[model samples]
Target: MKSSEAIYREALAQLQRLIEQATAQGVEEAHAAALATADRYAHPSVRMVYIVAVEEAGLLFFANTESGKGQQLIDNPRASLCFFWRELQEQVTLEGDVIRQSVETSDNYWRKRPRETQLAAWVLPQGTPAPEKGESRRQVRQLEQALGFEPVPRSPNWCAFRLQPERIEFWPSGWPRMRERVRYLKQADGLWSEALLSP
Candidate 1:
């Protein structure tokens, strides 16, 4: 049997290999594939998907407080997210900086949301105290009345922030730990360079 340390080392090796493949493929493709996989495994209660965005200096997180998932982001802004597509025996891992979405960007994404979602945004405080039951219900009713026939406007709180990825990893499961990994670093000229990692 592999020791705990060995298992961890194997995991890291797998992660490194994935990064290399993802980087070579391009960030956009990797993100799309990974997100799709994530959606499949996502639980209904997982309202916000953890995203790591880059900034001028470092990373930020965009996560919902409802499930306390934001706590993980806060504690470790640097993360390695795994997406496993069991049927294909494929997996991808992303490790990079994360940041919260800005109000403006959030608003843009908010506008694309369904009216019901927009209403829910207004009903929830997001990282703030939950309102009293009566008050909450009253607010919901008021919003419904105000928007009677028309769709509700997007809330300032419901926008998506930008996450600039510094690195991404992609790996397909196999024996001998010969997984493929790739890495990307945003250079001074704003171009990303891709490199392979040893597994």
Candidate 2:
């Protein structure tokens, strides 16, 4: 039997390979995944988000702190994510607790983004009421003009969060709805355990 550390490494390796394959197969938004979060009241909400980074510890994504998902994550740090690749007939699910990334990390990422995108972020505060028609674009243009040649600054309310997954499951499609499911659960000692689930 493999040790917990080995199983954990293998699961992450498998995920990386799947992500690469999906991208090679021309799947649009290959990094996109459905993120599920719940508020303090335990009310659940889900939305699609692009997984910006896949680290050994977990995955990372960004959002406005005042957004619904961000508020929910702050209130209840646990969340789930589901990634599906129709072309590869594969799916991966992750459940984990989230932690905000450091200010420096967020700044680095924000600096690398295109200027227009950064301006759009400033103008489009997530989950906020929509501005009057054309107001959003105007705001972006106005901000850009005001900033002149200076680099766009990162929004104080915008940041990234890392989801340190406690459970990860990989599903490979099989004929006639039969699928093979492999799950890895993180152990108390910070390792992991592997299991095969009926599908």
Candidate 3:
């Protein structure tokens, strides 16, 4: 049997290859994923978030600290993510403890965003109800005027969250019902190990 560390390295390489291919093919949502988070009581909440960064270290995504999932993440730092490449018939699921990124990291991503997005982030109060009807559109207009072409600042509460994965699973479809799952788990020695799980 191959050592877990060896298998993990191989799988990560395969994953990076898949992501690169999907991106190159002009896939609309190649960088999107379903992120699952739980609250203090262990109740789960799942939502889709754009995948900001993918690397050997782990995944990085940004969210407002006041959003529903963000609040949940604050209460319970454990979370998971699922990335599916439908055309390629492949899926990667990752789970780990969530930690806020440094101020510099969040600012870096913020600067990359469009002016509209940055302004919207400022005007939009996540997880809160707003006035009904055209209130949303009106708010956008107000936000645009407020910024007046100036640089949109990144919110301190809207920093990036990094997931240092403890588990990484790749599920690729096979003929009929013969599905396969390959998992990489972090060992106590601070290295990742791998195993196959029954579907």
Q: Is candidate 1 or candidate 3 better by lDDT?
A: 3
| Candidate 2 lDDT by residue in tens digits, 73-172 | 8999999999999888899999989999999989988887889989988899887899999999999999999999999999999898999989999987
What stretches of model 1 exceed 4 Å from their correct place?
A: 1-81, 99-104, 127-141, 174-179, 185-193
State each model's CA lDDT, in order: 0.51, 0.90, 0.83
Which candidate tops lDDT? 2
lDDT of 1 by residue, 77-152 (tens): 4344455544434675554555566676665555666676577677875767888768877888889998899867
Stretches > 4 Å off in candidate 2? none
88: Cα error in model 2, Å: 0.9
* Per-residue alpha-carbon lDDT of candidate 3 for residues 115-180, written as tens digits (9 for 90 to 100): 778777876767777768887779879877877877878867787988878888998764464687
> Which prediction has more favorable lDDT, 2 or 3?
2
| Per-candidate clashes, comma-separated | 26, 0, 0
Instruction: Give TM per candidate.
Output: 0.49, 0.95, 0.88
